[model samples]
Target: MSIQAKSERALCEITRSIRTRLQDVYGPASADSLFHAVERLIQRKRRTLSVSAGPRFSEKDALLITYGDTFLSPDRSPLSTLHTFLQEEAGSLFSFLHLLPFYPWTSDDGFAVTDFRQVNPSLGTWQDIQALGKEWKLVFDGVVNHVSSDSLYMKAYQHGDPDAEDFFIALPPETDTRSVLRTRTLPLLHEYQTTQGPKWLWTTFGPDQIDLNFKNPKVFLEIIDVLLFYVEQGCRMIRLDAIPYLWKELGTSCAHLPQTHQLIKLFRDILDWVSPDILLLAEINAPWPDNVAYLGDGGDEAQLIYNFTLSPLILHALVCEDASNLTQWASRLPPLPAGTTLLNITASHDGIGIRPTEGVLPEEARRCLTELAVRHQGAVSGKKNSYGTVCSYELNVSYFDALNDPAVQEPQEVQVRRFMLAQLITFAFRGMPGVYIQSLIGSRNNLAGVRKTGRARTINRRQFDLTEIQQELGTPGHLRQSVLSEYRRLLSLRRKEKAFHPDAPQAVLDLSPSVFALKRGGLPGGEEILALHNVTNRTVRVDLSRYLSGERYQDRLTGVSYARTDLCTMDLTPYQCAWLKKETLISA
Candidate 1:
């Protein structure tokens, strides 16, 4: 069937659902009015669907996570500078580029979006964005949960404009909302003294940001419209930022509400019709169970969910040199639905999230991470727990610094290897690996940036001069060059193997406490992979013959060939990882 035809049919069902939600939130009379308006919107415009084909996610599919201004230069615009860097130094290193929120912002480093439709003037023009789109698949952040209070839409609502009545979440002081989840320790309400009256807006992340009310059907439609606008701007992936906080009821804990799930399903249906290949990435940094829930029914919700647990747990395993906790948590993971997969990354624009480690990591293990961060001159940020006590929420440090403690004064080579070991663990997982720009370039703690911004996360969100970074990378045997070269090599090799597919059936192997072993089976053919990593500093021997079926075998990364008899005993050096293929597949 034609995309437009399928969308027309789906539009009928969506309109009905919206009408029901409207009635539930705003009553029958108002619902009828809203439904009429939504009908008009559907008739006037539908999301455009292009007929051209795009690349699907596969073993070759790796993502690069970076802020739009990550590669900055005095001589050129940030976007243009970034484009040139990718073309010259890092052509095709990543299959996809996840451009973090680049909208005009008042605070929170672009999360507090002042304008959704317009590109940040400082970042460059929309044409630059389109130019990059010609090469890489782009993932745009849909910061629909909140907007900057300085936004025109917020100003209109603050000035008592009737058209903006349903724009934001404002409530009476007497309303009880103690049950709501607290993503930050700031006050729940941010007061705004407007011309008409003194109003309070719900601010989930912080004061400069005001949450939108999904209960107000108009606000929901506004989000949908903005999403369509993103599609038009060449986004192949739409990441729903903090979507769990979209729906709130006074008496309930407003995290992952049923209404939120319904809204996501509606989005999936709409996006499938509008752009079938555009992947919806859900950024839920909650417990492991809650995180995977976004991949509902395998395909109805998000196609990709941030593997939040992997970051903290992998750090724990590497720092503690014990994979027991990581193995335990991963072993208990429920089977994911067929059409959906997980997106794993060692680092991001934000700090390493700790909430995802609630049950998986022991208190001592958690403390170990924080102490190591402090020793490395890294800041540990926290949020208020339910008991009103501040607890560590995240570790703010560059992935390089996070890997090794400064107190020990480890050699730079050791730190680089340790960091790459973590990346190896990330690639070994049955998920698409996302390489953070800082980790790839071997960046250290950006203390100057933090001092300038007075934000802990700034320690990792350091902007670099593309030319200088490239020079350092070009210098032979330099730490940056070594790290960048190894990273490129790993990615280049990882892309060609079939056993590293994101949807492969993976089983955690209980080999040894010091080693993290995973068996990835069910590739393009009968080929399988036995991934082994020695997280500890000492060499660990594992009898791989038990896992090997036939004679022809090779390690995917090193290309070291061996017969099944020789594979019976294998020793992995300190922080070494090997992707041992069962048999050489001529086709792959």
Candidate 2:
């Protein structure tokens, strides 16, 4: 088929898929209007690369996940300052910079977006984002699940405007919403005193944030336009925040709804048709089952789903000094498709969620991890059930602090080692690894931030002064400097091997309870990379004969080679992690 003909056919298929979804959520008339809006927007959006498919991400494609305001001063624009810092601190280390929610927000640390089209004034202008994009691959946040109650769209709903009447979810006082999943303990029905007097609006996340009604086709088109605007502005990947809750139905869990999955698939189809390079990464932080649902039959939905189970589970493994559960869970993960991979991250803007640890950690083990964080001066946020029982949801603390419990009073060097191990294992996981600002610089919990904001999540979202960070990172033997050096070394070693590609084959090796090992390779012409970690204080012996067929291997982290003696068993010191490359692959 001719190129133009193929393009037309793709457009028709996309339109058809979107129209069907629109009709399912709304009715025929709204579906037609929504399709027209999308068609016009797609036709007008030019400049996007018309590739057949996006190239698979590499181990070199490590992402630095941080807010645009992460590094700044009172005088300097945060985004511009961030660009400067990356050039010095993390430039070549991570290929992509994922700025979490740069839009103007009313609450939830920018997750409750007040305006999708405008850049937050404090975060600098679109020009700043473009500047960062020029220097590194940019990943923008798509906070489409809900909008801030202070937004203009909510104002229109208050005024009962025709086009915006159904933009938000609102039900009568007598309505039953008990089955809806609540991320917080706050009342689900937020009492809003608007121009329409008193309205009980659905607030899935919080009172300041209002759930958007995808039942309104106009809302879908509005969000679609915002996503396209991001792509036009040079975003290679757009992360959909809290996406599983996009569609709400009464007397149901209001999560992972069929309509929500349909909307995601619709988005992937339309966006890939427009620009195959722009990846749709779904931020569904549920357990493996619900989280895996976003992958959509292994192909059509999100190109990447955040491996939410990794961070907390890895922490649990290290805390308990047992990789048995982690190894068992990881072994069960099925192979990913040719181009898609999970987004493996150790930490982010929010706290370490326990929901993802449900299947991996036992009930008692789960409680212990949360208590361990609290024992180390961390806080726990809970969600209330119908019977008024509060269950722990997320542990609010820095990843470094979470791993190094003050109750045991681990030494500074030991704390740094444990923290770095957690971050390094993410690289060995079967996905694209990401580094968060707090975890990257080894920042401690900021109780001042939590007290000032009155939100537990702020404990780990502390903004650093670029000057102070530079000074501390340069200091020899300091915790920050130690963590930074080790993290950079991990990234440098990871990038040199093709076997570390996001889609490369991964086998979870059951070496011992005190250790976790991952093997990457086995593909034709692929280099075998072996990762070993000792999560305990005492030395543990691991036999290399079970993992490798070679007689000798080289450690990439340290330039050293050892000959296999007595079937090649090696002992690792406390909290030691080694990146081993096959002699054949390294010398070749």
Candidate 3:
């Protein structure tokens, strides 16, 4: 076939697939119109937007996740201050910057978006965001599942505007929504006074946030336009927040519905046609199987999915001084396709979620985790399950505090080592690593902030003034400076090794219960790195010859060499990590 003919055929197939998904959600009668409207939007976007096919994902790619206002300055906007901090302190350590919901929001920090198209004036303007994009790829939050109740669309709905009549989901008070999954303890339906009457609206998150009605084709088109706008504004990636609850069905779980998957496939198709470089990241905080479902066959849905189970599993291993569960879980992970990979993150804007550890960790283990949080002056959040029981949902503590108890009068060096070991394990995994801003600086739990805000998540979301942070980082032997220095060194080393590629083969080795060991890269003569992490508070010896082949191996972290009898066994100190490479590969 001619090249033009092949292109036409591909376009036809995409249109057909989109139309089929539309028909599945809406009726067949409305499918044609919706398809035409979507096609027009895509074409217009292609004509107006100049999306550069930027560099693809690679082993060197790492994301720095933070809020736009995490760094404050008296001289400029928070966004600009963040840019300055990155340029001066972070340098080229991170390739992507995930700005968590910088839009105007009524509540929930920035999740309850009041305006979709504009940035929060308190942070900065579009130019400021674009400036940051020039230095590092930007990841914007697609808070499309719901909007603030005070948003214009909700206001229009309340005023009975025809254009916004079907923008939100509202039903009778006694609607049969018991099957709907709940992520929070708040009521699923909240009574709202609308122009029609006092109706109960679905609020998956809370009262201030109202769910959008995807049953209406207009709502779908509106979100599509907003996503395209994000790409046009220089967002290389979009994090779909609360995506599992996008499409609702009365008698079903209303989570991860068939329609939700179809809609995500449609989104992937549209993005593939218009801006092929832009990636979609699904933020599903569910069990392992359900979380991996968002990566639908590895190519048709999200390009990246959060490895929500990793954080909790790492915590469990380190706290219990055993790596049995962590090794077993890593060995069982299904192989990912070429274009999709997991985003390994140790911490984020929210707390350490327990929902992802459903089958991986036992109930008693989870109880111990929550108990540890309370002992460390942290808190826990709960959610309501289908059984009408309130269960612990997540542990609200900083990653540093979770690993090192502040009450224990240990040396700062010991605490830093233990904390960095947890982070190093995430970096050595077979996926791209995402570093939270607070983790880079070894921040502790902010119980005062939690008390003031009356929100458990506030324990880790403390903002820092730019000048104060700079001073602290400049001081010698400071905890923040020590942590940041070690983090930078490890990240730099990771970028130089090809074995850390997201698609590289990983073999989880069970050498000892106190050590978490994994080998990256193919077997035989292929380039590889043997990563060993000690998850205990005492010295442990591991037999390297049991799993490794070559006699001589060199430690990348320290320029120490092991050969002959040394290769048979090696000792790792408390919270020590070693990245071993074959001596021949190092010489080459």
Candidate 4:
């Protein structure tokens, strides 16, 4: 067949798929109109702009997750300050920058977006974001589930503007929302004095964040346009924040509804047609099954889903001093669908999520984890379950503090080693590792910030001044310097090894309860690296003879060579991590 004919056939198929997905929620007539509108948008984009396909996955494709204001300067905008830091200090340590919502926001530290199309003036302008994009691939947040109550759409609704009347979900005050899933303890509906009358609007997150009504096709189209604008602003990936709660149904739990998945597929289809290189990342913090559902058969939904369970599981393993649960969960992780991978992250702006640990970590263990966080000067946040009972939702603490107790007067070196071990485990996983900016410097719980802001999540969201952080990182014996130096060395070494590629084969090794091991590569006589991490506070000996095919292997971190005869018994010091590659492979 001719190339033109083949292209036409492919486009028709995708258009039909999009139409069917829209029909499932908006019915045939509405679906027809929405599909055509989307097609026009895609065509117009194709005709007016040219976006190159982004670089594919490699061993070096790690992402640095940070807010635009993570590194603030007295003279410059936050985004510009961050750009300078990335170029000078970070260098090429990261391939992508996951810039957490940089748009104007009313609350939730940028999650409650007041404006979708413009950058927060406190941060830099679009030019600054594009400049960062030139240095590193960029990830932008699509906070589409809700908008700030102060947003123009909400203001219009308050004024009873006909165009904005159906923008949000407004129901009767007596409406039953018992079945609606809640991520916050705040009331599901907040009464608003609109021009028409007093109406109760659905506020899934909080009253300051009003939920959008997807039942209205106009809202969906508007969001699609917003996301496309992000692509034009040079974002290679768009993170759909709080996406699982996008579509609501009256008679069922308004989370992960079929319509929600369909809408994601529609977004995927449009992006695939217009800018094929752009990726969709779903930020779902639910249980394993529900979290993985966002991947939608691997190719049609989100290209990336946060590895939400990994953070809590790692904490549980380290605190409990047992790797059994972590190993078991890793062993059973199903093969990812094509074109999809998890974004392996141990820490982020928010606290470590407890919801993702459901079914994997027992209730007793979770409770134990929460209690441990408190002991370490952390806090626990709760959510209301369907039973109207409040349950522990997340542990709000810095990743470093979660693992190392602040009251313990241990040697700083010991704390740094133990913390890096947790980070090493994340790197050894079979996905792209996302490093939070705070984790890079081994930051502790900011209890002062939490107390000041009256938000538990503020414990980990401390914004650092550029001069102060630079001074700390420059000090020879400082904790921040030590952690970042080691982290940089490990990251540099990881990029050089082909075995650490995102698509490299991984096999979990069940050697010892105190050890977490992964065999990467070595499929069909390829290069292999045996990654071993000791998650305890004491030395643990592991036998590696059965796993090694070479007579000698060298530790990539320390460059220590071990003969096969010596592999039967090897001692990993407390909190030590080793990436062992065959001596022959290293020599070749």
Q: Pick the candidate with the highest lDDT.
A: 3
Give TM per candidate: 0.94, 0.95, 0.97, 0.97
Model 4, span 1-588: residue lDDT tens: 997898779778878888888899899878888888887877766664454456558788899999999888989999999988887778899998999999999999999888899989989899999899999989999999999999989989999898896999988888888887788988899988888988899999999999999998889889988888888888888999999899988767789998899999989988877777888999998999999889897568999999999999999998888999999999999988877888999999888999998899888999999999899999899988774788988898999999889999999998898889889998989889999999998798988898899999989888899999999999999999999998899999888888888778899999999999999985465679999999999999998878978898899999898988887788999988999988888855
Supply the TM-score for candidate 4: 0.97
Model 2 stretches with alpha carbons more than 4 Å out:
1-16, 27-33, 47-54, 385-389, 407-409
**lDDT, candidate 1, 143-230, per-residue tens:** 9899998998898887888878968878876666667778688877778877768888788888898999888777877887788788
After TM-score superposition, the amount by which residue 235's alpha carbon in candidate 4 deviates from its true location, in angstroms, is: 0.6
Candidate 1 clash total?
Answer: 0
List the pairs of residues colliding in candidate 3: none
What number of backbone clashes does candidate 2 have, counting pairs of residues 3 or more apart or in separate chains?
A: 0
**By lDDT, highest first, what's the ranking?**
3, 4, 2, 1
Instruction: Please give the distance, in angstroms, between residue 542's alpha carbon in candidate 4 and its true position after superposition.
Output: 1.2
* TM-score winner between candidates 1 and 4: 4
Candidate 4: C-alpha RMSD to true structure equals 1.5
lDDT agreement of model 2 with the native: 0.84
For all candidates in order, the CA lDDT equals: 0.83, 0.84, 0.90, 0.89
lDDT of 3 at 71: 92
